[model samples]
Target chain A: MPQTADTNRRVVLSERPNGLPDAKTLQLEHSEVPTPGADQVLLRTRYLSLDPYMRGRMNDAKSYAEPVKLGEVMTGQVVAEVMQSNCEGYAPGDHVLAGSGWQDYALSDGTDLRNLGQTPQNPSWYLGILGMPAYTAYAGLLEIGAPQPGETVVVAAASGPVGATVGQIAKIKGCRVVGIAGGPEKCAHVVENLGFDACLDHKSETFAADLKAACPQGVDIYFENVGGKVLYAVLPLLNAFARMPVCGVVSWYNLSGLPDGPDFGPAIMGTILRMKVKVQGFIIYDSFPPSLFKDFIRDMTGWLESGEVTYKEQVIDGLEHAPAALNDLLLGNSFGKMVVKVG
Target chain B: MPQTADTNRRVVLSERPNGLPDAKTLQLEHSEVPTPGADQVLLRTRYLSLDPYMRGRMNDAKSYAEPVKLGEVMTGQVVAEVMQSNCEGYAPGDHVLAGSGWQDYALSDGTDLRNLGQTPQNPSWYLGILGMPAYTAYAGLLEIGAPQPGETVVVAAASGPVGATVGQIAKIKGCRVVGIAGGPEKCAHVVENLGFDACLDHKSETFAADLKAACPQGVDIYFENVGGKVLYAVLPLLNAFARMPVCGVVSWYNLSGLPDGPDFGPAIMGTILRMKVKVQGFIIYDSFPPSLFKDFIRDMTGWLESGEVTYKEQVIDGLEHAPAALNDLLLGNSFGKMVVKVG
Candidate 1:
C-alpha cells in the first residue's frame, strides 16, 4: 500500500521516570516489521489513540491494569487496516480498531480485531467517541453518577474525550451541566457545542471562584478525571450526597509517585465525610455491566447518526511524529483527543 | 427514697481536650436535682454505656451528631430507673434506657424513653449486646459488608462491644473472622469467647506479619472502628472487593490532633483505587435503620440466651467517679463498657 516497504519503528521505555518524563526517557529506533503467520493479519495503523491511562502502563508499579514491560512496544489502542489476512472472518482491506501499540505495523492473530466495516465517513471517530475513552465516560458517569433531573453535574477536562462525553450524557439526563477546561476556546466549545449550561476555564486566574460562580446550585455529581487544584476548587462547591466517579487522575500521573508537596488527601477525605459524598474509582471494564455496553452502543450510534453529540480530534501526520503528539497530550497542550495517523 | 431526697453529683465539661481529655478537663460537683414537670420523669442513672463515639462529642467540630458544649453534662446512653413519674405510661420503679448525661439524676419528658421493662437477667446487657453498640455492629456489617459465606472478615478493637458483636455476626454469616485487639487478654477473649477464627495483638512487635499469617485468604470485610496502626496493618492484607464499615475511630481519640508523623491519607487513597475497596463512615442515628435494629435485637438476644456470645462489663462505683471512668474509657484503659453503678 505504501511507496516503500516498511522497516521497523518502535518506542521503548529507556528508564522509569523519577518525575515528569523527558524525551530522554523514551528511545525510538528502527527495527524489522514483524511478519504475520497462519491465521494472522499484518495491520497498517491509520490512527493511534493517546490517553491518560498510557501513563499508568509506563510505570512498573501495580495498578488496576498491567504496566508495559521495559524494552517493549509502548501499549496503545489504534485504528488500523488489515494489509494481509490468512484468518477467518477478517480479510485484506478490512478496517479495524485494535490494541496495535505505537508502531507503523503490527501482526494480529485476528483474535482482538473489531471490524470497523467497509465505509467510515469519519474514521477518526473510532478513536474518539466510538472508542474506549467514550465508553469509559458513558459507563462511569451514567451508571455511577446517576444524575437526576434539575441536578447540577460538573466535569473537568471539559474538551477531552472522556470529560466531553460525561458532560453531554449529564445534559441528556436533564441535569444542569457545567464544564471545566484549560482555555477559552475549549470552554467556549464545551458550552456552545456540547450544550453545557456553563463552562469555566481552569487556566483562568480566578478559576476556583469562577467554578463556584458558574454552579450557583451546588454540584450534585462531579465526574472526577483530574485530582489536583481543580479538585480542591470543586470540593467546597459540592452539595450533600454528591457522587464523584473517579475515571482518571491525569494531573498526578506525571509525578512518578505521590508528590512531596502539601498532601490534599485529608482535605478531600474530610470534605467527602462532611458532605456525605461517594468517591468511587472505577476501571470501565470492571464497573460497566454488559447491558450498559449494549445500551451505550445503541444510543451513541444514534447520537452520531443524528448529530446530537459532536466530537473533536487533533490528528498528527505520521507514526514517526507520535512521540511529540504523546508529549503534547501528556502536557495538556493538545486541544482534543490527540490521534496519531500512523500509516 | 434514701438519706438524700435526690442524688446531687454531676460531671460537667470544664474544658475541651486539646487531643484527649483528662480528669481536670471534667469537673465533678454536687448539683441540685430539680423536681419533674407534668410530662417529665426523673430517672436515677443505673448503668451508663461508655462508648468510643463519645470522643467526637468532646470536640466542637461538626459531625453527624452535634458536639457536647462546654459547661454541659457529658452525653451517654444510660440504663436508669424511674424514681418519680409525671407521664401517663411510665411510673415509679420502671426501668428504661435514656440518652441521659453523666449525672446522678436526669429529667426526661418521656418523649424519647425506651422502656426496658421490669424483668431482665442482666439489665446492663441492654447497654452492649442488646443495645446501640450491638445494633451499630449488626447494621453496618450486614447491611454494608454483604459478606457471603466463607468470606474472610476482620474487625479491630475486637474485645470492645461493637467489634466483638461485629466479628460474631460475621461468623454467624459463615465467614472466617479475624480479630485485632490491643493486648493478649483481649485477643484471647476475642478468639475463645467471641469465637473468632483468629486474633492478632496490635501492640505486638510483629503485628503486621502476624495479621498477614492469620488472614491467609486475605481480608474481605474489615470492620474499621479504630483508625491508626491497625488500619495500616489491614490495608496491605485487604483482598479485592473489600468492604470497610467505619463506625468509629477510638484509637485516634486519645490524640489532641494529628501526630507529628507522615500522614497515610494519600497512601489510603491510592490503595482504595488499586483494590476497588469501599470505605464508608456512618453514624448510627443518621444512617442506622430501625429494621436492622429489630433484626439485631432478635438475633443477638438469641445468641446471648444460647450462650454463643458473652460480654464483660467494667463497672465503676459511683456517679461522682464517672469523669475518671470516661477518661479511662477514652484511653482504652477500661477493659469493657465503663458503666456507673449509681444505685
Candidate 2:
C-alpha cells in the first residue's frame, strides 16, 4: 500500500543479535505522521538505503559509527520528499537526500537535508552511484590506494557498489583491475560488464592460485571491503609497497565468535612489514569535504552520462523487506547495491 | 691481534636456524688478508653494528632484503679505516662507512662507501645515532606516522636505537610520548634520559592497564618496532586516525612456529577498520633519497650538538662477540643500540 497522509509506518530495532540478525531484530509500528514545527520540514522517505555498515550499527559494540539503540528507528539515509515545509528555501514536493531513516515520515530541521530541487532524474542515484558509496570508492581508490598506470588493483565484492566503482576507477587510471566475488554469475558480470581484467570466484577451490595466475605482476592496490578468507588469499599475493584501502569488513560483521585457525596475526603483520605494505582504513562520512565532494559529483556525473562507468542496484520493494534484504546483503545473496523502495 | 696484516678473521653463516641462532649458526673462519685490486680500497673493520633485522637475514626465507647464504660472510655495516686505496679521491688512513659484514678486513670497489673523512669525531656514532637506525626512525615516524602537536605517540622497544629516536622526535614535534621497554631499568632510562613522557614495562603483569593509564588520550602515532604482545596491547588503545609505522617486528622474528591462540587476524583488521588506522611497513634501504638523507643528517647533528636528543650504545668488545650480541639484542638482554668494537 502507498504511504498515507495521516499515518506513518516505522521499523524500530527490537533486539541486538548474537550473530546474523534474524526475525526478532526489528519490529513494525504505526504512528501519526510527524508535523513540521517552526523552521522545520517534514520528510517522507521515498527510498531507504540498506548497506553493510548498517549491520555494524545493529551491534552494541563501538565502531566508526554509533550503534542503533533498541526501540529506536533504525539508522539509515534516504531519498526523501518534503511533505510539509515551514523552513526557508524548502517547498512541498521537493526531493532531497536526508537521514530520514527506515520510516515513512520524519521531522527535519533542515540541518541534514541536501536539496534535490522540485524534480530529479534518478533521485535514488543520490544514495548509490552519485552518493556515499561512489564517493567512498573514489576517495579511497584515488587518495589512499593511489592507483598507478599499469599497476594491478584487486577489489573484493566485485558486483557491489563500492567494489564495482573502485575496479572501474582503477581501470580508468590505466591499472589492470581484478575483481573477487562469491559466485560465477557475479564474476562473469565483473569481467564482461564492469570491465575488470579478471574476476575470480572467491568460493572456488583454486581461488588463491587463480588470483595469482590472473595477475602476473602482484597486486599493487587492494580495495578491501571483504575480509576473512579473501584477505588471507590476497595477503601473500600483495607486491612490495602495495596499498590496501580498507573500506569495510562485511564478511566478519556477522561473525559472533572467532573462526578456528592458527592465529594468523603474526603472518599478516609480517607480510605487511616484509612487503612494506600500507594498510589504511576509511569511512566516507565527514571524509569528503566540499571541494572533494564537488570533484566526485562532477566526475561521477560525467562518467555516468558518457557511459564510462555503469552502476547496478538491486531494489527491494516495501519497507518490511529491508530487514531480510540486509540479511541477504551480509550473506552475499543479493547482488549490487541493495535499497528499499519504501514509498 | 691489534694489527693483523697477514690474516683476516671472518664470521660466516654456518647454517640457518629453526628458531634462534645458537653457537652452531655462525662459524669463525681465518683467511689471508685480501689485496685491493685497481679502483678498490681495503677496509679494516673498526666497529661492526649488530641489529635485530640481522635475525631475519639469517633465515633462508624471503624478506624485505635477501637472506644471508650458508658459508657466506654475514651481512652488516661497519665503520672502518681505509688501510689501502687504489680508487681515485680515496686514500689510506681515512675512516668510511661500508658494508664490510662480520670481518676484520674487506675489499671494496669504491661502491657502498660513505667517506667519514680523517679525524672525524666519534666515528662510531655514524652506526647508531647518525645512521640507518636513526634514519629509519626519522622517516618512519615523520613521513609515515605524521605526529601532530598535542597527540599521544607510543614507541615499542624504547631503549633500542630506532625506538629511542622515534620517541625523542615525537617529543620534539610536541607530542606526548609513551615508551614501552622490557625492564624497569630501561623504562627509567627512557623517561629520565631519553625524555619520553612515560615509560612502561611490557613484562609487567599489568602492562596493558599501565599503558592505558599512561596515555589518557589514546595513541595517535605508534612506532611499531616490537610486535607480538606489545601490538596486541596497543591495538585497543589506538584512537581514530592513528598511524602505526612498522619499522621492525623484533619480537616475532625468532618464532619458528605459530603461537597457540585463536587467530587474532580478524580482530586486528577489524580494529584497523573501526578506528580508521593507517599501518605502513617500511625498510631503510633505498627509502631515504639524498635530499632526505641530507636533511636527516643536518637535523640529527643539530639535535645531538644541542642536546635535544641523547643516544645510548652498548659496545661489546671483539668481532667474535657479534653473534652472541645479536642473540642478546633479540632477547632484549642488551640495552641501547648494540654494536661490536671490531679491529
Candidate 3:
C-alpha cells in the first residue's frame, strides 16, 4: 500500500540559547511526517503548551528528564488527535494527551498518551489545569507543605498555571494565600480571580516589604516556582517550620553563569536551621507517585466541574508564533498558560 | 553542712575571642562562693564535662539558650555532690547533674540539676553518654537522621562524646560507619576501640581525598557536629536524599564573627535542592518530649553495662585550670570530654 508523503511542520532548536532564547534559536521546518507503526498512533497536534519547564528542556542540564537535543524539535505537552492508530482504545480522530512538542503533527508510540473521548470539556485544559502543571501545584502544596487553616501560603509566579492553581488550592484549604507576580494587573487577577487573600508585585521597589506586610502571620508554605529575589524576600520572614516545595527557578533560567553577588547558601542553611524549615525540590514527575494520577484526575476534574478551581489560558495562534510566545513566557510576560494553537 | 570555702576560683570572659579563644580572652579569678538559700542547695562540683556546645554559649548571639554573660561563670555540665540541700530529692552526699559551671563551689536553687542515684554506673558516664551531650547525639541522630541498616553514617570529631555515640548507634543499626577525627591516634582509637568501619584523620594532607575514598558508598547520614572546611569538603560527596542533623558548629563557634571569604549559602541550598538532601538543625531540649527519657536511660545504661560502648574522659585537675582548658577545647586539642575537677 503506497502512502502520501508525510506533511508535518516542526520548530527545531537551531542553536543553544546565549542568555534568553531569541527567535534565532529556533527554525521552522517542513518535513515528511512520521508514520505510526504497529502499536503506535499518528497524532495531529491540536494545542502545544509553552511552559516555563520548556526552558529547562532547552538547556542540557540535569533535571528529571534529559534535555532536548540540539537540532531536535523542542519538547512540551500537547493535546492532539489520533489520525490513525494500531494501539488499543484509540481510533481515528480520537483526541488524546501527548508529548508532541513544537510540531503540527507527531507520532506517539502510545507510551504516555491518554484518550479523550468525543464531546470533550475544554480540550486544551488537558494541556494545563488537568495535566502536569496543575498536578505539580496540588501535590507539592498539599502533600509537602501541608498548610493548615489560616496559615499563610505564598506562591511566586502567582498568575501562571502552577502558581495560580497553588494559590487557589491554598485558599480552598482555608489558608490565607499571598501571591507574588511581576505586575499589579496579574497580582489583582490573582487576588480577584484565584481567591488569593493578597497579592504582591514582585517588580515593585517595596516588594519585600509588601510581602512581609501581607504575611502578617509569617509564611508557613512557600510554593517556590520563581526562585531568585522572590526567594531572597521570602527568606527573612519565614516562620519556624516553614515548608518550601521548590519546583522551578524560572527567574534564573536564562543565566549563562553565576550571578554578580555573594552566594547566600550558608545563610540560607542557617535560616533553615534557625527556622527548622523544609525546602524540597521536585519535578512533577517525582513530586507525586504515579499511583496518585487517577485520584488526582478524579479530584481535580471534580474541582473543575464544581467551578472551585478555574483556569486561564493565553493562546497564541500558529506554530510560527511558538518561539516568541515561549520567549515571552520565560520572561514572565504571559499571564497564564501559553499555548500555541497548531491545528 | 558547708561547701569547701568558695575559693573564689572562677573562669570568666576577659574578652571575646576571634577564631579561637586565647588566654587574653578569658581569666581565672579566685572569688568567695555564696551561701545557699532556704530553697537552694550548695553543690561542690566533683566532675565538670567540657562540651563543644559551650563554644556557642560563649557567643552573644541568640540560640536555644541565652549566651553566657561576660565575666559570669562559664557554662558547663557538672556532676556534683550536694554539700547542703534545703530542697527535696537533693540531700548531702547525693550526686546530681547541675550547671555548676567552671567554679570551685556554687550555690544553686536546683534550677537545672537532675540528681543521680548513689549506686552509679560510672557517674561521669552521666555527662558523656547519659547526660546532655549523649542526648544531643541520640535525639539528633535518631530523630533527624533516621539511619536505616546498611546506610553509611559519617561523623566528624568522631572520638568526642557525641560523635562516638552517633557512630556506635549507627553500627548497632547495622550501618557502616566512617569516623573523621583530628589525628591518626584518635582515628585509630575510633576504629579499633569504637569498632567503626573506618576512620579518617581530617588533619591529614589527603584528608578530603581520603574521606572520599573511605566513604566509597557516600555519606547517607552526615552528623554535622563541626562546620567550616569539613562542611565544604562533605557537600560534594553527599548522596541524594542524605540527612544532616546539625547539633553544633564547633568549627565556627570560636570565631568572633562569620567565617571570611566566599559565602556558599545559595550553592548549599542548590545542592540541597538538586540532591533532595534534608539538612536540619536541632536542639535536643526541644526534641525530648519527656516520655522518651526513661527509654533513653534504660537503653544507654544497658549499652554501657554490656560494654558495647566505651567512653573516655580528659580530666584537668582543679577549677583554676578551666580558662586554659576551655581555650584548648575550643581549639579541638582535647581528645575526649574535657572535664575540670572543681573540688
Candidate 1 ranges beyond 4 A from true positions:
A1-5, A176-178, A183-185, A197-219, A232-240, A256-258, A261-275, A302-308, B1-8, B253-263
lDDT of 1 by residue, A139-241 (tens): 8788778889999998999899998988888887898999999888988999989899989988889999998998998989988887777887997888766
Every candidate's CA RMSD? 3.3, 1.4, 3.9
In what order do the candidates fall by DockQ, top score first?
Answer: 2, 3, 1
DockQ of each: 0.30, 0.73, 0.35
Give the best candidate by TM-score. Answer: 2
C-alpha local distance difference test of each model: 0.79, 0.90, 0.80
Ranking by TM-score: 2, 1, 3
Best-first order by lDDT: 2, 3, 1
Candidate 3 stretches greater than 4 Å from native: A1-6, A12-19, A22-28, A58-62, A255-261, A291-295, A302-308, B1-4, B7-32, B58-62, B69-73, B100-111, B201-209, B254-263
Under CAPRI classification, how is model 1 graded? acceptable
Q: Which DockQ value does candidate 3 get?
A: 0.35
lDDT of 3 by residue, A1-343 (tens): 1122366888898888878998778898888888878888888888888888777677776555788898898888898888888888888889998887888778778878888885577899887899888988888898879989989899999999999999888878899999999888998898888888889999999999999999998889988887778898898888777888877778877877656545455456555666667777766676467877777788888888898898999998888888888889989999898887787
The residue ranges of model 2 lying beyond 4 angstroms of the native Cα positions read B1-3
Which 10-residue window of candidate 3 chain A scores lowest in summed lDDT?
A1-10
TM-score for predicted model 3 compared with the true structure: 0.88
lDDT of 2 by residue, B114-210 (tens): 9999877988889999999999999999899988999999999999999999999999999999999999899999999999999999999999999
**In terms of lDDT, which candidate is strongest?**
2
